[model samples]
Target: MTPSQRTLLWVYAAIIAMWPIRHLAIWFIFRKLDILTPDSPRLTMDHPPLVTAIIPAKDEEGTLAECLASVCAQAYPNLEIIVVDDRSTDRTGQIAREFATADPRIEVLTIEHLPPGWTGKTHAAQQAADRARGDWFWFLDADTRHSPENLEIVMEYARDRGAALTSLLPEMRCETFWENVVQPLAGIVLMQSYPLFRVNNDRSSLAFANGQYILIKRSAYEAAGGHHAVRDRFVEDIRLAARVKALGLPIRVAIAREIGSTRMYASLDQLVRGWSRILYDALGRNPWRLLGRLLDPLIFSQTGHVAFVVALFLLARGHTSPFAFWLLGLSVVHHIFTYTVLARVYHMSVPRSRYVAWFPVANLVMDVILIRAIKMCLTGRVTWRGTAYGPTVTSSTRPVTKPVSPN
Candidate 1:
């Protein structure tokens, strides 16, 4: 090999060396949160707060009914369900209105138009909050389903921790081939990057929240200006969490594998489009940083597999010594260990978890998707909820000039 090639190989080797350190950091951090426990309680049930569950949906007819049904079945008694349908062309608005008419606690609101510099969904959520009568607000997506005890558990968790804002990272339901193979891997990558335990406690600027299931106190929501404050953010959940953190409000997040679940994207096209919508926002408009952040897991998995194959080839050719064989075994063992732990912590099944065994192959396939996402973000071509959004969403990120008061 030439000198340049040798240097590249060394660079690859260094990347491999760092993988275990990153994995260990994630494992140790999540281990504190007790993520493996299916029913770990973060709070007591006796003092659960009155909560309003709000869903801002657009054309979610297929999932809206089941989602509302789940909210109505909450174990917590002091609850209200408010569904804001944002100009849905489907029966989403009709279904929500029917449910509202049937139940005194449920109310349906039909939003007219999305104003400029406002995220379509957040505009609806802000309107829902205006009509909410509860002391706490829970924002959930239409695709999300909850277990009966979610509200009771989450409310108690907020009270015990004195958290103004709390969100649950639910176990994603993966049924389709793309959903099963690729979707769970996204969860794995997220867990690895931001350890849940550290994120909950450490008072760092690095804040993240899953929009699927968020529970926030009304006072805190108003204090931080609620969804109005982040009206235009594509990733409003995380932006609101960041604002809460910036204002020094207490924040808490819990693993909610048993409390709730969601099927975010059904097909490969959906996955790519959905992920692209916020990938740029998630990257904070930095292409190089985004590339670096995405490259780690891909390179790490590929290197381990390549190392094992080469070592095996050498051994079969009688060119490998005991140390070479040991190296190959150690690499494979470490990959298995990390992947297994990641899958288990993220609530994937045993067989599906074994898909990590094909990390090398999977990484190769995902790189194409990541590249496409980056291109979409860079080109300012993102579409969500039947509307196209431009790059960066600068206008939405601007704080509202007028303060909003609770109703």
Candidate 2:
């Protein structure tokens, strides 16, 4: 082989060797990070504070009833549930109203219009918060189902930790073929980008929270400027958590698999649209960060696939080398090991994790969706729950809402 060709082969071998080391480091860090669970012994409180649970609905008729039922059955004594029907053309409003009629604690707020510069979900949350009488505010999605003890345990944890804002990552429920494969891949990427341990313990201004279930003290919510503070943000949950953390308040995030689960999307098309509205905007519209995120998984997780492709090309040209073969084998082993670890961490079954070999397909799908999301955002064509937003829209706009009686 020519000296230049030999140099290229060494470079490729070095790159492949780095991936396994990175994966090992990630595994070590992940094992050390605290994985909060709800199975711990419950704590008792002298005074059980009233918590206003807000549910924002927009074309969520399929899941709203179960969500309401779960929230209504919470073991907590002092709790009120508010369901915001965000101009749904479906039975979401009707279901919420029925729950309201049956349970006096459940109130339905029907949103007639989504004002400019406000995302529908944030607008609905703001409306509920305005009329909330609780000392703490709980923002939950219409798709999430909570255990009866969910509220009690989460509240107890918040009180014990003195946390101003507490967000629980719900157990993800995936039923479809796409959901099973893509969800785990997406989650690994997300966690790597926003490490939960760092987000929880780091005082360097980084913060994150899942909107499926987030609870914040009323004082901290107000001090952080509330939902109206992030009215236009597509990923309002993370932004709100950042705002609260910026005020020097303690914010905690935990895994709540035992307490709740969320079915984020029913089908592939819906999943694409839903995540497209989030991923790009979550990058803060920074091109460099977006590029880095797009390439991260390809380099670290898919090094085996990359190596194989390169090896195939070299083989066809009759330029194969032992270094290339060794790199290919190493990359494959590293990829499988990393994926298995990811599956175990994310609570996927062994059968489901056997599909790790197909990760290249999943990774490609994710890349396409992310690139499309970026395009949609840049073109001012981002739409969520029937509301379209412009590229220039920001979270600084205040939402207008009339107060309603919590009683």
Candidate 3:
């Protein structure tokens, strides 16, 4: 090969290699990210703040009991638990009522109908907040299971940082084969997409929070207009965080793997819809970004590298070119490094060979999630908890309603 031709080929290879390098950088960022562990923050509050744990449920019969039990197990004293049964057709309300009967700290609220222009969860959360008498509103999803120290450690972290809103990065609990593979890769995509560093930066406008576990001081929650301000938002947690941060309130996102764990979906069907809604709303319904995100699984993630290695392996087996063999070796090394880092990020340990063997199938599932999300975004509506909502919902300005007696 001529000198100029060789130089041109090298340039092309470098350009193609940038994608994998970018993925590595994202994983490294997560590896060094802050973790709020069990033994963190030695300082103790003289008088512990009253924290109200609010959970909004809509047909969450399967997980409601465990969720309530976890919150009730919190080591922190001066705690209140509110569970809103928002038009659940299942045994969700019955289970919640059972908990409320057994524990004086637990309160259950039932809503007969969802007021127009508010997402069901947001509306339910607002109801719980309205009746909460705690100094802080600790929003926990019904699907999440928390460790005893979950509340205490986060409380200290927020107090030390003087943060108004705190979003905990929970340990994602995966059970099924699809859950094991797709969830971790999805977490990697979300972390990179949101960039927790930017979200937590005081000056950065970027803000994000996981709905599964968000702790907000009552004053800050009120200042940011609470859920009422973001009632129409499908991705209310993120919207609430943005509002808080925009108001110059300090927000913190931490690694809380020891504190809490959440299993987001029960099946592949739920997984697709759940992630699709998040991606569509989180990306601000931008088609171009959605398209790129759809392709990320196949191009920029470890799955992309895994596929590349397989392709190059096949080529190198028969090709006489030394470049093919060298490229194959490099790609294999990159995949191994990324795979290990991703496992560490999730606090999960799995055999690399097993993961790689199923990587391609999982990658396709991820793509389907983004694709469905894009279509939903373009269509300007999506369904949640069996309710269909437009791209946006708007409500008349109103004060928090007084709590009604549980049915």
How well is each residue in 131-162 modelled by candidate 3, as lDDT tens digits? 89999999989999988888888888888888
Candidate 1: which stretches are off by over 4 Å? 1-15, 34-49, 191-193, 306-354, 391-407
- Model 2 misplacement above 4 A: 32-38, 309-324, 344-354, 392-407
Clashing pairs in 3: none
CA-RMSD of model 1:
5.1
- The whole-model lDDT of each prediction reads 0.71, 0.77, 0.78
Candidate 3: which stretches are off by over 4 Å? 1-12, 19-28, 301-334, 337-341, 344-357, 391-407
TM-scores, one per candidate: 0.83, 0.89, 0.87
Model 2 poorest 10 in a row by lDDT = 345-354
Residue 341 lDDT (model 1): 51
For model 2, residues 195-264, the per-residue Cα lDDT tens digits are 7777778475789888889999999999999989998788899999999999999898887656788889
* Candidate 1: tens digits of C-alpha lDDT, residues 178-265: 7766766655544444556766874666677878878887888888888899986777888888888778887777766666778888
Better of 1 and 2 by TM-score: 2
Ranking of all candidate structures by their lDDT, best first? 3, 2, 1
Q: After superposition, how far is residue 370 of candidate 1 from its true place, in Å?
A: 2.5
* Candidates, ranked, TM-score: 2, 3, 1
